[model samples]
Target: MTEVGILGTGAYVPDRVVSNDEVGAAAAVDDAWVVRKTAIRERRWAAPEQATSDLAAAAGRAALESAGITADQLSVIVVATSTPDRPQPPTAAYVQHLLGASGAAAFDVNAVCSGEVFALASVEGILARSGGHALVIGADLYSRILNPADRRTVVLFGDGAGAMVLGSGRGARVRHISAHTFGELSGLIEVPAGGSRMPCDPAALEAGRQYFTMDGRAVRAFVEDQLPGLVKQFLHEAGVVPDDVRHFVPHQANGVMLDTVFEQLALSRAAMHLSLTRYGNTGAASIPITLDEAARAGAFRRGDLILLAGFGGGMSAGFALVEW
Candidate 1:
């Protein structure tokens, strides 16, 4: 069977930085309270002119440059984002245009925070069939959907993008990839309106349905209950023990949540990669952004065993084991 894996990676964050104090004031909370709750000191917010595709394109260019490939060489483009520029067209279409990847098959995927991993799984066939490469980018403009007054959801999100160029039979071999979704818990995090069920209007706007909402308690409970088990299952499938893994790149959910999950999995501090403090949770872009930072820092040794785990809204969870 043909092998498909990452060739190069890239990430981009908006220039506008929002400090905890600023966000706290908007949310009617103290700076200390905000920090204690989300473990985020600050986060990036997109400028009015910048949209999700702009971030994705910036990251895509970096990834392509890293891989020593041009946009036209890519056979497929898969973008995962919850906050699209508009509802009518898939965000990938704009990203494809921006990247000048006119020949690539482009589309979008939304599995909430698990989207990047989902996009990876979705594009395996393209890599295999083309016997070449594809670009998988995870970018989300969460700030666009946030309700400024709702600190619970607002403080936890940032806007950013991460991209990876994957080639057929290449670097960082993917040993296993898996995902599961708990639809019953889908309501835990959502943009309540603008969809077919509840079209956007003055009434929906009045109800604040246009902004994203999250059931913090339910989401916390769900992650505490399900994520660790999924991680264990993933390791089992990869036929590797937790301690043997050199890195555990998990979703940037939060400091407390990630620490708890790490403890439950019996993983050590040295084995974890975290970027929450600097970026908070960039939704689908979190894992790849974290991975890119680590790679750029020369954090991994050749032949190292790397594990990627992500879980979030859609109550979705995904894992990928890579031999670096």
Candidate 2:
């Protein structure tokens, strides 16, 4: 059997930097509070003209370059994002056009913060059958949907994209990937309007339903109830002990919830690769962005075991165990 794995990874954050103080004032909290609660000090925001596809294209291009492959070689393009270029014409189409990967199958996946992990899992499955390279990207432009005045969601999100090119070869094989979704809890975090249930219009805007709203308290409780135990189970099923893991890469959600997960798993802050403090939460793009940063810094060694887990808005969570 041909082993499927990432050939190269790349990430992009807009040049525009947003400090904690900027977002903190809107959320009615000081910079210290933002840092204390979420450990996010700064994040990048896309320029007014930049959209989700622009960031995705840039990251995808870099990934292709790193993989030493051209866009035409790509057999598939799986873009994971909650914020697409538009409600119609999936964001992957735009990215595919930008990359000139005309021959590849293109589509978008929306698992919110867990988008990349789920997309990667899908890419692996696709490659298993197709036997070719695939570009998996997680990109989002949260600033557009977030209520500028709503401190809860605005302060925690930013604009960015991350991508990885997967192919058949000798590389870090993703040993195990498991995912589960709780549809009943989907309402825990969401954009209340714009979907079929509540179409976007003047009434929705006036009611403030158009912006992204999150019950921070509820989300924290939900993650606390789900994530740590899921990680432990995934590790157990993969037949790997916690100590054997070289790195635990999880969604850069927040500090408070992360603290709980760390305690439950008995791991130190250093063991869990985190970029939340600097990049805030880039939604679905968080995991891959952090992975690209770590991989670029020469973080992994041969035969090392790495764990990747992500959880968020479909009220979903998943983990992928990799052998480097």
Candidate 3:
């Protein structure tokens, strides 16, 4: 069987930087308060003209360049996004057109913040069976869906894109992957008025129910209890110990959640990678963006084990063990 691994990686963040001070000003809080609470210093926001597809395309192009491959070589393009450019045409198709990957199959996956891990798992199955290369992109234009007045959720999100090229018969290997979802808890964090369940209406719009609503305290409690077990189970299933893992990249949710999981699992700060302090949470794009930065910084050498875990709406969670 052919092993699948990342051929290249890239990320794209908008030119504009929204610091804690700006958010605090907009929300009637202090910068220090926001930073101490969320551990977010600044985050990138997409330009008004740049949609999710545009962000995905930028990162895709860089991934192709890094892989020394052309767009024509791509056989599949999977974009994971919650905030699509529109409700009809798939964002992945738009990205494919932008990259001129005319013959490639394209589509979008929606699993909220767990999107990238889900997309990667899907592509892994495809790559392992078929003889083709895929461009997997995680992009989110989260600001478009945020409510400026909703300080709790607004402070935790940003806009960015991250991408990786996956191919069969690779030099490095994605050794194992596991993902799970609890649909009963999906309502805990979601846009209540966008889809069939909560169809858009004049009333919904008037009440501002169209934007994202999160039960922050509920989500924190749920994740703190469930994620540690899921991650540990997968690592043991992968036949590796926590100490053997060279890098641990969890979803860039917040410092509190990050610290909770780390503390519960007896994971030292040395075992993890921290990017939320600088980039905020870019949803599905978080893990890949951090992975790309760490890779560039020579954070891992050959034969190192890299552990990735993600949790968010669906109330989904996933874990992957990669050998770099």
lDDT of 2: 0.88
Over 1-324, each residue of candidate 2 has an lDDT whose tens digit, in order, gives 557988889999999999988877767777887777788889999999999999999999989998889999999999999999999899999999998899999999999999998998898988988799999999988988988777778888889999999999866788889988999988888998898999999999899998887878988888877777887888889997777887888888896678777777764423678888888899889988998998899998888888888889989997888887
C-alpha RMSD for every candidate: 1.2, 1.4, 1.3
Best by TM-score: 1
Q: What is candidate 1's CA lDDT for residue 59?
A: 92
* Model 1's TM-score against the true structure: 0.97
List TM-score per model, in order. 0.97, 0.97, 0.97
lDDT of 3 by residue, 1-324 (tens): 668988888888899999888866777777788887888989999888899999999999988887778998999999999999988789999999999999899999888888898999999998888868899999998888888878898888999898999997654589999989999998898998877877789999999988988999999988988987887788789997777877788889998678877877655433688788878999999988888888879888898888888888999998888888
Worst 10 residues of 3 by lDDT: 262-271
Relative to the true structure, candidate 1 has a C-alpha RMSD (angstroms) of 1.2
lDDT, candidates in the order shown: 0.88, 0.88, 0.87
Clashes of 3: 0
lDDT of 1: 0.88
lDDT of 3 at 177: 90
